[model samples]
Structure formats: structure tokens, C-alpha cells
Target: MKNKTYVLVIIALITLSFSSMAQRVDRTNFKAGVHAGVPFGDISDLANFEIGLDLGYHWALSELIDAGLSTGFMNVFVNNDTVDFGSFVLEGDFPNIQYLPVAAALRIYPTYDFKLGADVGYAVGVNQGNSGGLYIRPMVGVNVGRSTEVNISYVKISDDYDFSMAALGILFLF
Candidate 1:
């Protein structure tokens, strides 16, 4: 009898929880954004800066959680036509390191105006002779107004080598 009573209590609590969670209905949304930043760490020696466009579709998993798919294009510009490696200098054109990121994204809204998020997936090398690698980004964001958001993020990709950058981005939701 005690075991059955405990089971009944658990089910009652769960039902109440779901009913409260269901009070707020959220709709699917689209996000588009752009960002620019300078290359840092290992790739800094080979590249100057990067700019990218972000596109994503998100569905509300709960009142405060969003799950989505994210994709973006990034181009890291070559530093110079000539590169110096301390002991030697070579002169010629070098290709910019360019890649596209395809990732699973999740964001949590701690408050109506604040959010934290992350993306993990693969970066596909789109530049000639470039093979892409794993992609990861963690971000913090602020809601600017009704339909705009501003965010700062760290971008990292590891292939045969690890490359990273710091970016500030803005988005318009539709």
C-alpha cells in the first residue's frame, strides 16, 4: 500500500509539472546573422581576420530551451602575400582558409533578455586543398529588442590542425 501511494504521488507531481510547462506556447523561428573577428592561436600566423553569415532554424523545446540546426560560412583572410617564418620568407599568393560549419545548436534562456548557447558539429572545408574538421562554438547573447539579438562567441575548428577566433555577432529573427 505504501509503494502504491508513493507511485501515485509521483504521477500527480509530474502531471502538475507538465501542465504548468504547457502554459506557455512557443512557435518555431528563423534566425539570420553576421559576424566578424580576427584569427587567433595557431591559425593567426596564416590568417588575418574572418567574417561569416549565420542561418538557423529553431523550435521551442520548452519555455526557456531552444533546439536547432545551425550553418554558416566563414572566411579567414590570408595575412599577406608574403609570409615570414623567422628563418625564411616565401613570397607568393596563398589561399584564404575558408570553411562552412554545420552544427547542432542549443540555447537556454535564463531570463527574457539573456541567453547561453552552444553548437557542435563539423566544419566542412570549402576552400581548395582544404579538408575540414570538427566544429564547436559557445556563445552568450542578449536580446536587443523584440526581434533582434546580439551575441559574442568563440569559434573553434580542429582538422589536421586546430584553429580558433573570437567573434561578435548580431541576428534578426524571422
Candidate 2:
């Protein structure tokens, strides 16, 4: 919990600095943009799909360099098996194990509409059973419009328990 707070603070500070410097950039050459993406992944034996939404603030650090703060909620579902009270077996779906991830990533643009990035962040699970997990994802994104993008990544959490796929449907700058 404390770690999550600190990461958010750091991202906030960086964003503030970027916002202040954005006006000074050449308006025609560089611009900042906002993006939102939905990321999907698979959890181990628990759920078929793990999905999340990301909201990011991006700055064109350079033509080839970009940095941003990404925050989002991820839902991880699992199956729970319990025995019935002197009866047949009982099973049902349960609420998702949720996560809040705050991350910073560097994106490199290889072409006008293609981008690749690597991200590192702290994932704090919002469930009591799962305290939290830390993870890293390397992704590929394609710009579909001035305000939209799509991306995919492979993500893994520490302790080697879960490895999953992450797909993002994004809204962002051109």
C-alpha cells in the first residue's frame, strides 16, 4: 500500500514537470497527448481472461522518445471449489481479484504509426487474499488514429506463479 502511494507520487511529479514544459515546446513539432487503453491477459488456471483499463498522460520527450504515467484497474478471476454442506458439490463464480497499476514507460516510435515500449511498475492487488504483485511488460502498439491505438504485451508477476498476455485497446495522441 505504501509503495503504491509512493509510485503514484513520483508519476505525479513527473507529469507536473512535463505539463509545465509542454507550452515551451515548438507547437508544430511536439505535442502531448492523453491515452486510454484496455489491456487483456490470462491468469493461471483461474480465469480465461484478465482485462484492465489504462489512462495515461504522455509527453513527446523527443521524436524517438516518449514517456508517460499509466494507471489502471485489472481484474483477475479465479475459480473457487468448495464442498456442499452434506450434499452434492457446489461451485460458483466469485468477484474478481482487482489490481491498481501505476507505471512509467518509454516508447520508441519506429515509424509514423508504429510504436514499441517497455514498462515497469508496481501492481497492487486490491484483494485481501492477494496482497499485491510487482510486474513488467514489454509491448507493441500501433496508432490507428489521432486519438487511438492498440497494443499487446506479455506480462509476468513475481514469485513465478502467473504469466499472462496483455492486450490494450487505446485512445491516444497521433
Candidate 3:
């Protein structure tokens, strides 16, 4: 599809740019990751789970800090059947929520295998009648190997209403 082609082209361009930056930065690396989470808050009754991918370029700013740009896709599946709580009942049949997250990434390493970071940016809506909103995720990670890291993060995407969750993710560095 034309839309897929456009996204491929953009990703290729960004990868090319990061490759050039890597030539001058000894600590730079490319990372790709996957995440999944359960919907909570006001949306808990309306949605199920979400899954996504994270791709980024991270370069060391100092021995203990890393920073770069990050973008990813996330999809929140809508609950199509009516949801019943002990106190009341609500209906479903709503459209799924999806977004493209574009944000700045940063990490602080306190030890060789431990890090803390957050991504702050905007989520571009990918479905009809959705305009998206501000996105923020704070995360903590532990290295599993030289090239793999596992992390836990809390995600918030808010506008008039909020689509929030607690997620677990993993990243592979190259």
C-alpha cells in the first residue's frame, strides 16, 4: 500500500541519518523493542490489552546518560461486548484506539545493568475520529545480556480523556 511505502521510506531515511551519527559517536546504538500492556483507568471498562513496537537511536551523552529519538506504534483493542462491574454495567462496540508515538528518549544508568528513563512526546491518532494526544512513559530497565534489556513502564496518552496503562517491554540493542 502507498501508506506502508511512505512509512518504509521515512524509516529508511531516519536509519540512514542515525548511521551517519553513529560514525562519529562511539557509544551510539540502534534499538528495537516490543511491548504489551493492560488498559486501566477510565478506559479499563472500554478496552482490552495493547501491543506495540519501539524503535530508537540512542547515543551516550556521558558515561551514565543516553539520549535520542524514539517512535513507535501502539494499538489498544476495544471491548466489543458489554462490560459488567459489580456496581453497574456499560456497553461497548467502540472503535479500537491506535497511535503513533514520537518522542525524545533518555536514560540514566546508575549501574552497568540498570537504567531509568522516560519518553515524552505526542501520539498521532491512527483511526477515524481520533486526534491523539500528549504521550509520556517512565521506565525502568535491567540488562539481560550484552544486547538485550527488559523494562517496565507506565504509559499515559491524554487529551480530553486518557488512554493509560502499565506495560512490560524489552529492547534489543545493536
Candidate 4:
């Protein structure tokens, strides 16, 4: 866990330096945004929705390339109508587990308003015994206009579970 935070700090420093040095680099095109969405899978099938906030920062390296970081909360149901995790069945009555994920992303923008990105990072569950884990996220987004876009992402965490979700929200470009 300590190592994970250190790595995230290093990545943030590198990105910040690059941003500062690249004058004329449409940094405004780089953006920060918040997101919330329902995950699909056994959780959704069980009538459980994982809702959380996303703090995303994106830097447009070029017309076609970009990089960024995202950290957020994840709520997973323990038990419900579907299979159970241990004795818990992920359902509406189950509690949402909060996981803090920090990821570095590389994005390819085919159009000024559209992008596809691959994200690599780590996640730490706040609950005891939940174990922090490695994760990868593949995401796509479409810029709606003026710092707003809709995004969808596929996430694999800990090699134990896969999460797929779509978020409709705004990307605030600084």
C-alpha cells in the first residue's frame, strides 16, 4: 500500500513536469472531470448498482495522444440474488465496498471529440481484509462540448472480478 502511493506520486510529478514544459501544448485540452455510473455484471444482475465519484485528469499530448490519472471509489455488493462472495450474496441489501484506484492512462484520440485509452493502476479497498490489488482499465470517451464528455470503461481488478460500466458526465479542461 505504501509502495502504491509512492508510485502514484511519481507518475503525478512526471505528468506535471511535462505539462509545465510543454508551452503552447493546449493544456486546456487537458481536462479534469467527475463521473458516476452503474457497473454491469453479477452486481447489476443482482440489482446492485455501484455508484461513485471519479477524479480524472487528462493531458492531450497531441491530436492523437494523451495521458492522465484517475482515482475513485468503487462499491461492490457482497451478496444478493446472484452468487455470493464468501457467505455474502451481492444484492441491494449488501453493503458497497469502497476501493481507491489510482491509474495512469494513455489515450488515442481519433477525433477532437473522441478518445480511447488504456489505463494501468492499482486499487486499495478501504475495508479490512479486502486486500489492495492491481487493476487495468480500458476506456473510451466522447467530448460533448465545452468540458463535458461521456465515458465507458472496462475494469479488471485483482484477477478475481471484472467490472464494466458507462458514465455520462463532464470533463472539465483546465
The candidate that achieves the highest TM-score relative to the unseen native structure: 1
Worst 10-residue lDDT window, candidate 1: 19-28
Weakest lDDT window of 10 consecutive positions for candidate 3 = 19-28
Leading candidate by lDDT: 3
For each candidate in the order shown, give its overall lDDT on alpha carbons.
0.87, 0.62, 0.87, 0.67
lDDT of 1 by residue, 1-174 (tens): 999999999999989766755652343379999999888876887787899999998877777888899998998998667766668776888888888999999999898789999989999999898899999999999998888999999998997765989999998888
**Predicted candidate 3, C-alpha RMSD:** 13.5
Per model, state how many residue pairs clash. 0, 1, 0, 7
lDDT of 3: 0.87
TM-score of 2: 0.65
Please list the Cα RMSD from the true structure of every candidate, rounded to 1 decimal place: 2.7, 12.9, 13.5, 11.6
Per-residue C-alpha lDDT of model 4 across residues 1-174, encoded as one tens digit per residue: 999999999999988777654752554544555656666664455434555566767676654677878777776644444455565754445445567888897888787688788778998777765576786778788877755777877666663455555545456665
Write out the backbone clash pairs for model 2: 147-172
lDDT of 2 at 53: 64
- Which segments of model 3 are wrong by more than 4 Å? 1-28, 83-92
Q: Per-residue lDDT of 77-109 in model 3, one digit per residue for the tens?
A: 888988776588868577888899999999998
